[model samples]
Target: MTESWWRDAVIYQIYPRSFADANGDGIGDLPGVRTRLPYLRDLGVDAVWLSPFYLSPQADAGYDVADYRTVDPIFGTVEDARGLVADAHDLGLRVIVDLVPNHSSDQHAWFRQALAEGPGSPLRERYHFRDGRGAEGELPPNDWPSIFGGPAWTRVPDGQWYLHLFAPEQPDFNWDHPAVADEFRTILRFWLDLGVDGFRVDVAHGLVKEAGLPSLGRATEWHLLDVGESPCFDRDGVHDIYRSWRAVLDEYPGERIAVAEAWAPTLDRVADYVRPDELHQAFNFSYLATGWDVESQRTMIDASLDAMGRVGAPATWTLSNHDVVRHTTRLLQRNEGDVAGRKPVEVDPVAGLRRARAASLLLLALPGSAYLYQGEELGLPEVIDLPPEVRQDPAFHRATGQDGYRDGCRVPLPWSGATAPYGFGPDGGPSWLPQPASWAHLSVEAQEGVPGSTLSMYREALALRHKTLTEADSLCWVDTAEGILTFTRGAGFTCTVNMTDRPIEIPHPGVLLIGSGPFDATGDSVTLPPDTTAWWSN
Candidate 1:
């Protein structure tokens, strides 16, 4: 194992709309994020990956980019982004912006030109156009289900069809078209030249539509993208698209990383995205959404590492993010089922922290970069019964209960519930999402001194991780036995997490650098208390 800055880096993702609001308005803006740089710097993340803040109609909450080069009025202006980049750099944090090359908002000038020009037009080719594909181009080319819901293809008013793998508003780009690839290259250079370190590519795996555009293996229900068969994205030659990006990134130094949002089933294909000439790392989502069964987790971790171990880049791991339920909430749901047949997972936010620490130790000890979503350090629980009326995520709206999509993972960062805006907005006027009443007790300020609070434990764990920052490229040697997951980060650093409620023994020990409360793994054998974890640097 060797040292790599990206491997050791802690990248924090900020969903600007929910992070903080400087304006009296309910929504968060760039100014709000600027005010929070000190907080983020205090947290000690190596980088900040800002989600899309580009100009948009908010139809998809910034994912639908109307103009890649400009900031949405709701968020701020181009000058504000410049200031953000400068401020983040001053804080010793690198910056990465969202690169959504797959599609653009219908309001984008390209899409508007496509609407204006019929099929085969220059801009028309920027998006997928297959004649005689759907219900008069309304239905998709196959039975694949869109992640948001419905068929992946839709018809234009001009009687031609375009493909959109996620949302109708997000029309899939025809990466095959040289013009489409050229457009994204320009977009990439636009931001890179603007001083962004790199990009967190949106749906990176799906950039290349399958050449054949095959139909679903089964003909019942929604489109097949969800269940496979529709290989439009993540198809072969996808690397070509990435290679193109890589060639551009190579022009710059600093090892600028491109974290691909690779959501695929097989590891071999996912591994392809991280080849040295392509993406730097793809999201290892299997672990992020795996069932908590120990065997399942071990296999997922081992399988992912084995896959990437054969490749050029390190595999990244994330417990939860903006698109998934908080790991704490998910664990609670699994441990305590049946709350009036709905499940008892909804309200058990208190018990999540210690377990979260144990889990964090479990993930951080693995190979590759560990993504810490905003508020994850606080062991934030999913807001229960988040009413659909206030649901801002387009994934939830499109899925409509089909799959437990993104809404649970996204909630207003609880600055202070007793405060006017829960500490998220200016003058505490209104929050985009209703702040939970429990936030009063769960805020960062409230948990700073409280022993055993999730907030404190997370900060401690992060500090401990800082000690092993040099071991980024280390191999993950895992030992799953005796109700614990033990692994060594490189040769001199070994860590173990006792997930069970009872104390467990350890195989070995060097130095007790850090651990959750009630833990002891001394001299060949020791006890790890219920809900405890330990780290060593020796």
Candidate 2:
């Protein structure tokens, strides 16, 4: 692997609580992940990005970090985390863990001290604490709403309010405090010493806020993250934080990198997070948010590559994550938004899966790194029918409607077995989020060696990408029929995706290497079925 292996790597995301369970406790832990190293290595990913497993009360599903250095008891001990990193390294795969510097669990020692010591304590300065605005000081300091739901400011018994951009259980940190910034640098070194390769900075755009903690004036909308008007998120000051962190990562031996989960409104602003002296890569969310249309996809692709290239950073592509609806279900519709509390919309499952497969091929064939969410390789769709009583997402509990609930995508992965637990745990214990009966067929064992299964397709494409596409430094567009996209990578590699209604002949003639769906070839042309993508090598 090269110093900048992440430039064109395929990284797999493992949502710890739902990945695999070694203990009969029904939740996945670090030891379980260590045991699955071979599976990921075999799947052909260059790296594995583990979501938060830090000590927490599980509010916001571990995104609320109580201790940056301690592993949660449910996830495993510190020794287990060390072992997972060592084992992953032995498999020749890089490890990238989640770092949530924007907020901390309310149960964190700093938050506890701030609460006990009242408004005047130095600990209180590390967080946002202010007096309420009403005549009796009863109203919140500001009208900003939590991204989860309701008010972002929570008042304490002592008449002071603390800000939390997310759920109340997760308090936003004050980046202006020198101690807060210094503390995160210490935390970064703690993991780097353990031989981990990098960190995925969660909410990377939200470290700083506008000077004044002013009211947003209007009812808050969660989709406003990229609007740049919010006082709480994506402020320009956040880049300084990354610049300092980059200096720390540079001191290490391997080219340890930082990938930002930033949601800036424009590609140029998102690029700011990955400027030569700052973080390494920022997720190209504009591409993920785009609907399945040629024009929309093409525009976002061009914009992302252009902006990130200007900054000398590789663009990162992602299709799904633990927080939102899976793309298989998302691409079935013409709209792009969360699928929580809304009435279930009808979709042709067959068609949705087909489009998802095609989209995967198109994304992998692009010129930068790609992230694969857990369970997506098996063609898992969102489990929208979760019973209300068992749902544990903070978004569902705080909001009146389904706009924020993300539990459907966090169901435990099925390894083997035909029943409910599906080998997720040793004793087949009940999963934290119930798996749909339909998942019996989507289990890893069910699709492992099946030639045309989604799992097989991903493995083959990823292997091909590592062998052929990784070294291609440029791509040239080839004119194609309306609704079809054709581009060549280097001189011999061509990728074509047909989005039109009818089968269209591939413009470039080359030996068929792999495809998302069936294709037919003659001496001069190849016919691609509708809603399919193919890779060819001349």
Candidate 3:
């Protein structure tokens, strides 16, 4: 089997709206990302996975792409995107752009034409346009609910209903339509020719649905995250779509790859998306959703590695993303990283930051690729106190939105300076979402040279990862005390994590290379503090 760069690559995901803003527009743009390429290079990431910046109305941020080929004016022009990709390459950094294939913005040219040409138009065939089911055709065709909330079907003035698995502004594409498939192939080639390394396919498991638009028929509220055998998600036919995409990726040189943002019921199903003839990697959401304990993390990690290994694919690990509450905050919750259940409890920010640092080391030491969400290196917590008026997440507006609010994690990153905007924009304009005043101390500039700072820790760990752990593919568990986990990679590298509230003694003979927090070592024995982790060279 041919080796792939994505197998062990460290990919950093940048949420464009919050990354950095140029032209002082209060929104991050491709130009902004261009100017910041050196920063990412310095951080030691092999590639950057950019969230959507394509032409869109911003209904679901940029996920609702209106034109796959065009860049939205708010985020800059097509020239700017090309320039950004070129700039990233100059820094020896690969670029992975997001591809929202499952749906497109309602304002897209094809969708607009479908709406204007009425019910029987051939253009309407490209989308899931169907007649309503009631006597007067007043009801939605099925019981499927929008991921953002409410019914998944939207009615047109012509008495027909169109399916929107997400928001109404985003209409699902009919992959059964040859034209839809052909259009995406053209879109893929256009970006590939422009030199993008790969795509992080949005909703990779959702292009196809059951033949009959059947209802789930459950009384409880619907959640998009609920995986397993569902008529609308992870259908058996999505694999064929990926096979065609893999062929497109193979046409490009330098081993261009595609990563799936697929959410299936199990790691086994997730692995299917990355089979030999499919994508290069699929996000291991099952691992991300695991709790922050020794046993829970260990179980999920084992299951992920085993499942992906069976298919000859490397496992991927990530802690935070644009959609979920930041791990820094999630860890502090009483639920220990379960964002789904709404339980109110006091949060200990200090402990959360400590645990987050430890978690990062544990993830980086694993035998596969790792994804870092922007600002995580600085230990930024989710901005949970955004004013109601400033909230813009579509889910927040809907009564049935699975996650009550996601804007907390999408707040603009703190770059430098004090006060709001935090140097996010060159003109010091207001940000799209407000930044917490406390983040002034967490700005990249503040942590750039500070020893023991979160950013400094990430830089050191990632640098060491390249030199020592990149090719260390084998992992063996080392027996240790309860609440403490120890593992060895290859011959000379060891990682020990202390997950309990009490310190644990490490009996290994080695020099500590990195520690998440301060610890004590006397002679041959070292004590790891609570919620701390350490990497050592034996």
Candidate 4:
């Protein structure tokens, strides 16, 4: 209930590689971001969180850090980062950077040194290492799977194996080691010292593992990430890690926040990541994972609220991220609370963008800060046409012929469709990732201020929220009949959404505050155009 700067903040997440390439090297850089600072400010967000620009081998798209203190040559130098922070601050927008402490690239000097030497190496304690003492190391230690679809352990070729919760390239750090903890704390201090606002931590929940590294229970399905039957690390020690990080954060004087990317099914564990001193927010992916149903949204919200009540941590809701399909695609999957077990109903092609816009409104309406991935406001959809030659995402590379990888969501941001460079750079120059044909129409420059365009609608939506952030208490959901979601926002304000194409009666409401299509309100009911929605505020 206490007022915090991030409480009502609208955060924009920018993946630098795909954001914009100022140099036309086919990769987006800090200067490109610097060029786009005004664009972000125009979006009316409280802060901009840059995904990772640290020195890396690009093994996992910069999540695999080789050096924590400097920026990768592709993204520019530490000076560029400083300039970005300065530019963002000058524009009244807070600057946030991603912190990937859970793992480091296998090519990192520390890992290389650890591989070359034994426990006495300077980087020895930075990672998890174990010796296979008996039977020629047949059944070495425990069963664990790498998040990227292999055993969590890989042979050092030194007759030993180390743990990697994610990709083999991303070796998990050993939080049990005090030296490692100090190193990450130092990394945090280094960035904060740069006048940066805060961090968006990668996998904060899995920071600390079970000390014993016990066996996971019996399982039928064997996912490479599910190291179950080997050990369940999402236990008590996580809190210790958070508490330690919190100590480091406390040492800093100014307003700083941390958001964790935890994807636990239950909210209790999610809440742990956001404990007061631990993290400021955790992604409420329940909505992202939720099917479109009145009951689904209601139940997820209630559970999230209850969990927040227990831990006193504010909850975050997200419809889409760089990791999954966009919300518009998900909306196509949601039905009007009617029958299922039939063919997947095709979303009205005409209303697809509107659904995406409506989803944006839904996320902003929630209690916690809204995290918008780059280009979501432009009604960006997943990219599918990139040939394997142009694909750089590990998710796709690992999936080998898998249809649903994250690269689609991680495509190059479209600045202008008509421009040959797609607003990233010159046509002849390289783009880190390829832009699809549809991007031509769904670009920022093309749609800005255009009536019925996703860009303008998003601007209006954010402006509306900025006008009413302090009066959020008036925001409350009312009735859900006939697949319609009607809610009241602050005081007597009410909004009703009829998610179907066929006209349907809406619950009682005053006048329509805003609408996406034709709607008529009667005494106690309203008729909504097919595949349309409306908002009301009295």
Candidate 5:
């Protein structure tokens, strides 16, 4: 890969707890990921982005980090992390680890020290410790709501309240403090010394909050994809932090990079995180949230390209991640009425898979980086029926305005076998989250050699993309019917997606390279079935 390989790389996100288990303990570990390095290499991804594996109390699924330098016992030792990086590098794959800088676990040494040192201690200044309002100081510092629901502040025993934008157990840091910036510099050096390729900055837009901790002045429930401006997120001050971080990353070789998991009000605003001197890439969430229609997709794609182009950075595209519903289920439920009503929208699994397959083709054909969640290649649908007793997403307990059902997307993958656990761990071992018995038909073993399977489709598509597409960052929209979207990337590559519900005949573009589903071609035109995507060589 080139020095700017990330410009058009395919990065896979590995949610450690559900990816693989190496110790027979029903939990995924770094050793398990090391064992799968060859599999990822063969899958055609240029890098792997791992979610948090740091020391944590498991609140918010490891996002509440206790120690930035230590590996959680459930995930193996620090040596295992080093080994995984070495193994991944051996396979010519880069490794990007998650860095949760917005907050720290309540158990973190700094947070613990702040609590033990009382209200006036210097340690308390490292975090957002403030006096509350009202005559008796009983109310929170402000009216800001947690992204996970409820107030964003929690009172301490010493009559002071600390800020936490998600859970009380995860206390927000005061980026204004010099200690916070100095400590993160040390942490960055620690991981860079460990040989990892890059960092995925979790909540990258949330480090800096507006001064004075002002109130929102109105009640509002937060959504994961909320684009509204907030005093607590996407502040201008955040860019300075990334610029400093970019300096740290530049000190290392191998074009070490950082990708921001930022949720901004616009694609142009999101591009600010990826300015040449800031981070390397930012997720294009607008494209991910777009509905399954030609106009919506086209507008978002054009907007994303334009926004990133203005900054001279490559646009990144992703459909599913651990935080939201898997696209297989999401695309099928797009037309479901009133998602705001929080109704349990019924999903048609067959139709969902069809759209998901087409979406993958579209994602890969785009002229930028693409991110694939762990089980997306297998076409895993959201396991929406997990019993409440076994659910672990903190949002569920918080009763957030959002669906709070991220567990449905994080169920353990089905590698083999026909029963529960599905070979996630050792024989007879239990899984952290139960897999559906129906997953027997969706296992990697089940789809390994099956023709027309989603797994097979992804493998072929990725392989073809690398072989045919050039480094040229040009994409031109081709004129097509109302429900069909067609574009060409560079000279010989053309991709088209049919969003209509019926077969549509169009003039044949060129020799068919691959397609999401079967199609019939005559002398001058081809019949594309409903909800299909195809790639051709012009």
Candidate 6:
């Protein structure tokens, strides 16, 4: 691996609660992840980014961290995490753990002490505690609504309201407090000492808020991807905090890195988080949110490359994560058009998988780091039929403007069985979120070496991607027919995608390396089927 391995590298995201459950507790743990390291290493990814397994109340699915220094019992002990990191390194794979710096669980020792000490206590200053509005102090301090739902501030018995941009269980931290900053730095050192390769900083853009904690002035629901300036997020002050964190990472050996889970109004703003002196990479959400059309895809690709290029940073691309519906299902939904005020549209699974396969080729062919959410490689679709009683996403309870159904994508992975729990744990053991019965065919055991399986396709694409694109950084657009996007990377290497519904003919790029779907070649030109992508080399 190169010194800057993150650049053009593929990182797999593991949502621990659903990745694998080793102890039959129905919850995935560190040991389970350790057992899966070999699978990821074989999958050709350079690193694994584990979502928060930090000591937590499991509110917000562990994003509401109660302690930064220890692993949650549901996941494992501190030593377990240490062992996992060591095991990953031994397998020649890097490990990046999630760091939730923007907020701490309401159950955190600091937050608990602040509540017990009442207002004006020094501990209270570590969080955003403010007096309620109105004569009786009966109203929240501000109009800022939680990203999950309702007001962002939750009132306490002391008549003070504390800010929680997410759920009430997660109180936003006061980064201006010297102690808060010092504590996080200490936490970084703690994990660094444990041999962690880096951190995927959660809510990296929200650590600092605008002064005065002003109101949004109108009713608006905040979605994860909501752009436009906000007083609570993407504040200028957050950069300094990252700059300090960057210094700490540099102190460690092995080119330790930091990635920002930042959502900003534009790619330019997102690029700011990845400035040479700040974090190493920020997710290219714009590219992920782009529609499956040649015009939108090309526009986003160019914009993402340009924005990150200007800052001397490699852009990061991803399709699905723990927070959203899987792309296979999402793309199918898009094809159905607006469902607002309408019954759900029946999704055609075949079409969805085809588009997803084509999309994967496009993602890998791009010139930057790529992230693969677990299960996406197996072509898992969102489990939309999950009973409401089984739903656990905080947003679902809040009924926020956001879809609030992230649980659909968080179901435990299917490994090797044809029944419920499907090798996720001991036979007949429970899963925190139930898996769909149809997953029997999608299980890793089912897809493992099957030539046409999505898993096999991903393995092949990733292997080819690493071999050909790792050392190549240049991407030049190649003129092609309308509804088709084509680009060349290194000499004699080209990637083309057909976005139109009908087959389109284009000049023969070169010897076909791999294709998302079959194509017809006649003499010096090739006919690419709709929703297909192909790579070629001379």
- For every model shown, the clashing-pair count is 13, 2, 0, 13, 0, 0
| Of candidates 5 and 3, the better by lDDT | 5
lDDT of each: 0.74, 0.86, 0.87, 0.72, 0.89, 0.88
Residues 293-332, candidate 3: write the lDDT tens digits: 8899889988999999999999999988887777887766
lDDT of 5 by residue, 46-126 (tens): 999999999999998999999999999999999999999989988999999999999999999998999999989899999
Location of the lowest summed lDDT over 10 successive residues in candidate 5:
335-344
Scored against the true structure, residue 506 in model 1 reaches a CA lDDT of 61
What's the true lDDT of residue 462 in model 5?
87
User: Candidate 3 local accuracy as lDDT?
Assistant: 0.87
lDDT of 3 at 37: 89
Q: How well does each candidate superpose onto the true structure, as a TM-score?
A: 0.90, 0.97, 0.97, 0.90, 0.98, 0.97
Of 4 and 5, the candidate ranking higher by lDDT:
5
User: lDDT by residue for model 6 over 478-499, one digit each (tens)?
Assistant: 8899989999998878999998
List candidate 1 segments past 4 Å from native.
Answer: 1-3, 133-141, 220-229, 335-347, 417-420, 449-451, 472-481, 490-492, 505-511, 519-525
Residue 53 in candidate 2 has what lDDT?
Answer: 95
**Positional deviation of 118 in candidate 4, in angstroms?**
3.4
lDDT of 4: 0.72
The better-scoring model by lDDT among 1 and 2 is: 2
Worst 10 residues of 3 by lDDT: 337-346
Writing each residue's lDDT as its tens digit, candidate 1 over 1-538 gives 1225786577899999888888868888889899999888777778899999999988778898999989998898988898999999888888889978888998999899878878778888778777755445554556665767667777777777777877889988877778877778888888887788889998877777666677767644332123343466567778878888899987876767788887665888789998878888888776665655456676788888789889866778887776666777765566432111122145445556667667776776676778988888776777767787887666555644444345556677877656645778767676777767767777777776677676766666677677664544465656656677666766688777666767766656677777766554456767677666787776
Error of 1 at 510 (Å): 5.2
Estimate the TM-score for candidate 4: 0.90
Weakest ten-residue segment in model 4 by summed lDDT = 337-346
- Give the TM-score comparing model 6 with the true structure, all chains together: 0.97
